[model samples]
Target: MIRGEAYVPEEANDVWLSVIGKSLAYLCLKQAEQADPDRMSGVLAKVKFLMGLGLSQDDAAAAAGSTAQSVRVMKIRKRSSSGKKKKKRRTS
Candidate 1:
């Protein structure tokens, strides 16, 4: 549905859809990692993004080799953080 050819039901559409979804998710995560190598959390963000795009949370987690429970936990932790900055110490 995202600027690609639509598959017909008789042609194993679900299989093709799942494949495309996983590939797109992987590409997104890879690009994010390239921008921030220290952040493994990018994968979880990718999963959530895919879910927002209509893929089931279970399918997204499966594509990432994780569980829905883990995804929810990560999301909760991410949101619970306060966007406050720590004071920087100056050294001569």
Candidate 2:
């Protein structure tokens, strides 16, 4: 049963209707995002929230419409401050 009061027809009682007959869920989600100026698909919010809660960059990126590899590289770049450390020479 669709318990939520929101008009998320994707949760309809009939499976086939929701999957194909009634409406596409992606389009509905996009419409909802378009209606709100503050939300960019509302995905970034969730992604950031997840990351804040200890989720890895790869997982967070997937939810944020970003690639895992890209997130990894971004994290590396963000954390990197200086160039490679210099090695000390030992005196004999």
Most lDDT-accurate candidate: 1
In order, candidate lDDTs are 0.73, 0.56
Compute the lDDT for candidate 1.
0.73
Give the per-residue lDDT of model 1 (tens digit) for 30-83: 686688666645668667656765678887787667888998888777766756
lDDT of 2 by residue, 2-73 (tens): 677556465564676534522343344346557764764455454555466455556556646788777666
The TM-scores, one per candidate, come to 0.48, 0.34
